[model samples]
Target: MGLNEAPLLFNFEVESSENFTFIPMSVRFNLDRFGLRITLAQWQMLPLEDRKLLARFPVDDDTEIEPNFDHALFEMLRTHANVEPEWFTPEEAPLWRRTDSVPEGVTHQAGLAGLTAPSVARWAELDPFKRYVLAKLSRKPEANHDFVPAMKEFGGGA
Candidate 1:
Protein backbone atom coordinates (compact mmCIF):
# COMPACT_ATOMS: atom_id res chain seq x y z
CA MET A 1 0.00 0.00 0.00
CA GLY A 2 1.27 3.45 -0.85
CA LEU A 3 1.42 5.70 2.21
CA ASN A 4 2.19 9.36 2.81
CA GLU A 5 5.94 9.52 2.44
CA ALA A 6 7.96 10.51 5.55
CA PRO A 7 11.36 11.98 6.16
CA LEU A 8 14.34 9.62 6.29
CA LEU A 9 15.04 10.58 9.90
CA PHE A 10 13.50 12.61 12.67
CA ASN A 11 15.22 14.91 15.17
CA PHE A 12 13.85 12.98 18.16
CA GLU A 13 15.72 9.80 17.40
CA VAL A 14 19.20 9.21 18.81
CA GLU A 15 20.77 8.32 15.49
CA SER A 16 24.03 8.83 13.74
CA SER A 17 25.03 8.25 10.15
CA GLU A 18 27.95 6.30 11.63
CA ASN A 19 26.28 3.54 13.71
CA PHE A 20 22.57 4.04 13.24
CA THR A 21 21.80 1.98 16.34
CA PHE A 22 18.09 2.52 16.06
CA ILE A 23 16.01 2.07 12.95
CA PRO A 24 14.66 5.44 11.85
CA MET A 25 10.91 6.05 11.84
CA SER A 26 10.85 6.37 8.06
CA VAL A 27 12.24 2.84 7.64
CA ARG A 28 9.76 1.49 10.18
CA PHE A 29 6.90 3.29 8.45
CA ASN A 30 7.90 1.92 5.07
CA LEU A 31 8.41 -1.56 6.52
CA ASP A 32 4.91 -1.54 7.96
CA ARG A 33 3.51 0.04 4.81
CA PHE A 34 5.08 -2.78 2.80
CA GLY A 35 4.36 -5.48 5.46
CA LEU A 36 7.96 -6.57 5.94
CA ARG A 37 9.75 -6.67 9.30
CA ILE A 38 13.37 -6.89 10.36
CA THR A 39 14.75 -6.88 13.89
CA LEU A 40 17.25 -4.39 15.29
CA ALA A 41 20.02 -6.99 15.21
CA GLN A 42 19.29 -7.83 11.63
CA TRP A 43 19.42 -4.15 10.84
CA GLN A 44 22.79 -3.87 12.56
CA MET A 45 24.15 -6.67 10.40
CA LEU A 46 23.50 -4.60 7.30
CA PRO A 47 26.19 -2.36 5.91
CA LEU A 48 25.85 1.36 6.58
CA GLU A 49 25.18 2.06 2.91
CA ASP A 50 22.46 -0.59 2.78
CA ARG A 51 20.81 0.81 5.91
CA LYS A 52 20.92 4.25 4.33
CA LEU A 53 19.17 2.85 1.28
CA LEU A 54 16.37 1.46 3.43
CA ALA A 55 15.96 4.86 5.06
CA ARG A 56 15.85 6.74 1.75
CA PHE A 57 14.12 4.37 -0.69
CA PRO A 58 10.77 5.60 -2.06
CA VAL A 59 8.88 2.31 -1.78
CA ASP A 60 6.00 3.99 -3.57
CA ASP A 61 4.90 5.08 -7.05
CA ASP A 62 8.12 6.82 -7.89
CA THR A 63 8.83 5.20 -11.24
CA GLU A 64 12.50 6.07 -11.09
CA ILE A 65 13.11 4.34 -7.75
CA GLU A 66 12.34 0.72 -6.94
CA PRO A 67 8.57 0.56 -6.53
CA ASN A 68 8.60 -2.47 -4.22
CA PHE A 69 10.47 -1.89 -0.96
CA ASP A 70 9.69 -5.30 0.53
CA HIS A 71 11.24 -7.24 -2.32
CA ALA A 72 14.33 -5.10 -2.68
CA LEU A 73 14.85 -4.78 1.08
CA PHE A 74 14.50 -8.52 1.64
CA GLU A 75 16.97 -9.14 -1.14
CA MET A 76 19.50 -6.93 0.59
CA LEU A 77 18.70 -8.40 3.98
CA ARG A 78 19.06 -11.94 2.70
CA THR A 79 22.17 -11.35 0.61
CA HIS A 80 24.12 -8.78 2.55
CA ALA A 81 22.88 -9.31 6.08
CA ASN A 82 21.79 -12.97 5.77
CA VAL A 83 18.60 -12.09 7.57
CA GLU A 84 15.14 -13.42 6.83
CA PRO A 85 12.33 -10.94 6.63
CA GLU A 86 9.46 -11.29 9.04
CA TRP A 87 5.98 -10.31 7.99
CA PHE A 88 3.47 -8.58 10.23
CA THR A 89 -0.17 -9.44 9.75
CA PRO A 90 -1.94 -6.54 8.10
CA GLU A 91 -4.51 -4.64 10.15
CA GLU A 92 -7.82 -3.51 8.71
CA ALA A 93 -6.60 -0.03 9.40
CA PRO A 94 -3.16 0.62 10.83
CA LEU A 95 -3.12 3.20 13.63
CA TRP A 96 -0.86 5.61 11.83
CA ARG A 97 -2.85 5.49 8.62
CA ARG A 98 -6.07 6.54 10.30
CA THR A 99 -6.63 10.26 10.67
CA ASP A 100 -10.11 9.99 12.14
CA SER A 101 -9.12 8.73 15.58
CA VAL A 102 -6.37 8.98 18.15
CA PRO A 103 -4.84 5.70 19.35
CA GLU A 104 -5.31 4.67 23.00
CA GLY A 105 -1.75 3.53 23.51
CA VAL A 106 -0.52 6.92 22.45
CA THR A 107 -2.90 8.59 24.87
CA HIS A 108 -1.76 6.32 27.66
CA GLN A 109 1.89 7.09 27.14
CA ALA A 110 1.26 10.79 26.86
CA GLY A 111 -0.61 10.70 30.13
CA LEU A 112 2.21 8.85 31.82
CA ALA A 113 4.66 11.30 30.38
CA GLY A 114 2.61 14.13 31.92
CA LEU A 115 1.85 15.50 28.52
CA THR A 116 -1.55 16.07 27.00
CA ALA A 117 -2.47 13.67 24.25
CA PRO A 118 -2.83 15.05 20.80
CA SER A 119 -6.46 15.75 19.98
CA VAL A 120 -8.30 13.89 17.24
CA ALA A 121 -8.19 17.04 15.16
CA ARG A 122 -4.53 17.55 15.98
CA TRP A 123 -3.75 13.91 15.35
CA ALA A 124 -5.43 14.07 12.00
CA GLU A 125 -3.29 17.05 11.13
CA LEU A 126 -0.05 15.13 11.54
CA ASP A 127 1.55 13.09 8.78
CA PRO A 128 1.40 9.30 9.03
CA PHE A 129 5.06 9.07 9.94
CA LYS A 130 4.59 11.23 13.03
CA ARG A 131 1.56 9.16 13.94
CA TYR A 132 3.64 6.05 13.47
CA VAL A 133 6.26 7.37 15.86
CA LEU A 134 3.67 8.22 18.48
CA ALA A 135 1.80 4.91 18.18
CA LYS A 136 4.96 2.84 18.24
CA LEU A 137 6.60 4.72 21.08
CA SER A 138 3.50 4.65 23.23
CA ARG A 139 3.08 0.89 23.07
CA LYS A 140 6.64 0.09 24.00
CA PRO A 141 7.54 0.88 27.60
CA GLU A 142 11.22 1.05 26.83
CA ALA A 143 10.49 3.42 23.99
CA ASN A 144 8.25 5.76 25.95
CA HIS A 145 11.18 8.06 26.41
CA ASP A 146 10.74 9.23 22.88
CA PHE A 147 7.05 10.03 23.18
CA VAL A 148 7.30 13.54 24.56
CA PRO A 149 10.29 14.36 22.43
CA ALA A 150 8.40 13.28 19.33
CA MET A 151 5.31 15.23 20.37
CA LYS A 152 7.44 18.30 20.96
CA GLU A 153 9.10 17.89 17.62
CA PHE A 154 5.80 17.34 15.80
CA GLY A 155 4.74 20.61 17.43
CA GLY A 156 1.05 21.16 17.92
CA GLY A 157 1.92 23.25 20.97
CA ALA A 158 3.22 19.99 22.49
Candidate 2:
Protein backbone atom coordinates (compact mmCIF):
# COMPACT_ATOMS: atom_id res chain seq x y z
CA MET A 1 0.00 0.00 0.00
CA GLY A 2 1.06 3.59 -0.52
CA LEU A 3 2.41 5.58 2.42
CA ASN A 4 -0.74 7.70 2.66
CA GLU A 5 -2.83 4.54 2.73
CA ALA A 6 -0.31 2.33 4.44
CA PRO A 7 -1.02 0.38 7.60
CA LEU A 8 0.64 -0.11 10.96
CA LEU A 9 3.53 -2.57 11.13
CA PHE A 10 3.24 -5.55 13.42
CA ASN A 11 6.33 -7.58 14.27
CA PHE A 12 5.56 -11.18 15.21
CA GLU A 13 7.11 -13.20 17.98
CA VAL A 14 6.47 -16.85 18.83
CA GLU A 15 5.19 -17.89 22.25
CA SER A 16 5.62 -21.29 23.75
CA SER A 17 2.79 -23.03 25.51
CA GLU A 18 2.89 -26.24 27.49
CA ASN A 19 2.74 -28.26 24.30
CA PHE A 20 3.90 -26.11 21.40
CA THR A 21 4.74 -22.69 20.07
CA PHE A 22 1.52 -21.06 19.01
CA ILE A 23 1.30 -18.50 16.25
CA PRO A 24 -1.11 -15.84 17.41
CA MET A 25 -3.20 -14.59 14.58
CA SER A 26 -3.06 -10.80 14.17
CA VAL A 27 -3.47 -8.02 11.64
CA ARG A 28 -0.04 -6.94 10.47
CA PHE A 29 1.42 -6.01 7.13
CA ASN A 30 2.62 -9.08 5.29
CA LEU A 31 6.18 -8.62 4.07
CA ASP A 32 6.70 -11.91 2.31
CA ARG A 33 7.27 -9.87 -0.81
CA PHE A 34 9.55 -7.17 -2.17
CA GLY A 35 9.75 -3.63 -0.82
CA LEU A 36 9.62 -2.30 2.72
CA ARG A 37 6.41 -0.32 3.17
CA ILE A 38 5.16 1.13 6.44
CA THR A 39 5.24 4.44 8.29
CA LEU A 40 7.61 4.90 11.22
CA ALA A 41 4.85 6.48 13.29
CA GLN A 42 2.55 3.46 13.53
CA TRP A 43 5.43 1.23 14.43
CA GLN A 44 6.19 3.04 17.65
CA MET A 45 2.55 3.09 18.75
CA LEU A 46 2.33 -0.68 18.90
CA PRO A 47 1.52 -1.94 22.39
CA LEU A 48 2.74 -5.11 23.98
CA GLU A 49 -0.15 -7.14 22.59
CA ASP A 50 0.49 -5.93 19.06
CA ARG A 51 4.14 -6.83 19.33
CA LYS A 52 3.17 -10.22 20.72
CA LEU A 53 0.89 -10.88 17.78
CA LEU A 54 3.55 -9.76 15.36
CA ALA A 55 6.04 -12.06 16.98
CA ARG A 56 3.66 -14.92 16.22
CA PHE A 57 3.36 -14.20 12.51
CA PRO A 58 5.59 -16.32 10.28
CA VAL A 59 8.54 -14.05 9.71
CA ASP A 60 12.12 -14.26 8.52
CA ASP A 61 14.80 -11.95 7.20
CA ASP A 62 12.72 -11.63 4.03
CA THR A 63 9.78 -9.96 5.76
CA GLU A 64 9.75 -6.32 4.64
CA ILE A 65 7.03 -4.28 6.31
CA GLU A 66 7.65 -0.94 8.08
CA PRO A 67 5.55 1.22 10.41
CA ASN A 68 3.94 4.53 9.54
CA PHE A 69 2.16 7.41 11.34
CA ASP A 70 -1.43 6.99 10.24
CA HIS A 71 -3.93 7.01 13.09
CA ALA A 72 -6.38 4.79 11.28
CA LEU A 73 -3.65 2.31 10.53
CA PHE A 74 -2.48 2.51 14.11
CA GLU A 75 -5.99 1.91 15.43
CA MET A 76 -6.53 -0.88 12.98
CA LEU A 77 -3.25 -2.37 13.98
CA ARG A 78 -4.32 -2.33 17.60
CA THR A 79 -7.85 -3.56 17.06
CA HIS A 80 -7.00 -6.24 14.55
CA ALA A 81 -3.94 -7.34 16.47
CA ASN A 82 -5.27 -6.98 20.03
CA VAL A 83 -3.20 -4.17 21.42
CA GLU A 84 -3.41 -0.92 23.31
CA PRO A 85 -2.72 2.05 21.12
CA GLU A 86 -0.41 4.84 22.25
CA TRP A 87 0.54 8.17 20.84
CA PHE A 88 3.82 7.54 19.03
CA THR A 89 5.65 9.60 16.51
CA PRO A 90 8.12 8.26 13.98
CA GLU A 91 10.83 10.70 15.09
CA GLU A 92 10.57 9.35 18.63
CA ALA A 93 11.68 5.83 17.82
CA PRO A 94 15.30 5.07 18.78
CA LEU A 95 15.88 2.66 15.93
CA TRP A 96 14.91 5.36 13.46
CA ARG A 97 17.12 7.85 15.28
CA ARG A 98 20.89 7.46 15.06
CA THR A 99 22.50 5.98 18.15
CA ASP A 100 25.78 4.55 19.43
CA SER A 101 24.44 1.04 19.53
CA VAL A 102 27.63 1.34 17.52
CA PRO A 103 30.43 3.07 19.35
CA GLU A 104 30.51 6.31 21.30
CA GLY A 105 32.07 9.32 19.48
CA VAL A 106 31.44 7.64 16.12
CA THR A 107 28.98 9.11 13.60
CA HIS A 108 27.83 9.05 9.97
CA GLN A 109 28.79 12.61 9.19
CA ALA A 110 31.35 13.09 6.45
CA GLY A 111 35.05 13.96 7.10
CA LEU A 112 35.03 14.05 10.87
CA ALA A 113 33.86 10.42 11.28
CA GLY A 114 31.50 9.22 8.56
CA LEU A 115 31.04 8.05 4.99
CA THR A 116 31.89 9.78 1.71
CA ALA A 117 29.53 12.16 -0.09
CA PRO A 118 28.40 9.57 -2.63
CA SER A 119 27.85 7.13 0.19
CA VAL A 120 25.74 9.56 2.25
CA ALA A 121 23.80 10.52 -0.84
CA ARG A 122 23.12 6.90 -1.58
CA TRP A 123 22.16 6.18 2.00
CA ALA A 124 19.85 9.19 1.92
CA GLU A 125 17.99 7.73 -1.04
CA LEU A 126 17.21 4.51 0.79
CA ASP A 127 14.02 3.97 2.76
CA PRO A 128 14.42 4.61 6.48
CA PHE A 129 14.54 0.93 7.42
CA LYS A 130 17.12 0.09 4.77
CA ARG A 131 19.02 3.17 5.89
CA TYR A 132 18.91 1.65 9.36
CA VAL A 133 20.64 -1.47 8.05
CA LEU A 134 23.31 0.54 6.28
CA ALA A 135 23.79 2.64 9.40
CA LYS A 136 24.16 -0.50 11.51
CA LEU A 137 26.57 -2.09 9.06
CA SER A 138 28.64 1.07 8.84
CA ARG A 139 28.51 1.93 12.55
CA LYS A 140 31.69 0.03 13.34
CA PRO A 141 35.10 1.26 12.23
CA GLU A 142 35.88 -2.10 10.62
CA ALA A 143 32.79 -1.97 8.36
CA ASN A 144 33.21 1.68 7.29
CA HIS A 145 35.24 0.96 4.16
CA ASP A 146 32.93 -1.76 2.90
CA PHE A 147 29.76 0.08 3.93
CA VAL A 148 30.83 3.29 2.18
CA PRO A 149 31.34 1.43 -1.06
CA ALA A 150 28.14 -0.52 -0.52
CA MET A 151 26.19 2.66 0.15
CA LYS A 152 27.66 4.31 -2.90
CA GLU A 153 26.74 1.26 -4.97
CA PHE A 154 23.34 1.01 -3.36
CA GLY A 155 22.55 4.65 -4.04
CA GLY A 156 24.26 4.51 -7.45
CA GLY A 157 26.78 7.07 -6.24
CA ALA A 158 29.58 5.54 -8.25
Candidate with top lDDT is: 1
lDDT of 1 at 154: 94
| Candidate 1 lDDT | 0.73
Cα shift from native, residue 93, model 2 (Å): 2.3
Residue-level lDDT tens digits of model 2 in 56-119: 4432223333343233444656665545344332323334233324323124423333443333
- Ten contiguous residues with the weakest lDDT in model 1: 58-67
Q: Quick one: how many clashes does candidate 2 have?
A: 13
Off by over 4 Å in 2: 1-92, 95-115, 118-124, 156-158
Misplaced by over 4 Å in model 1 are 1-7, 14-18, 59-66, 141-143
> What are the per-residue Cα lDDT tens digits for candidate 1 across 7-117?
367777754323577787768766777667888888888887777767776534233355566776888888987778888775657676688888988888887877888
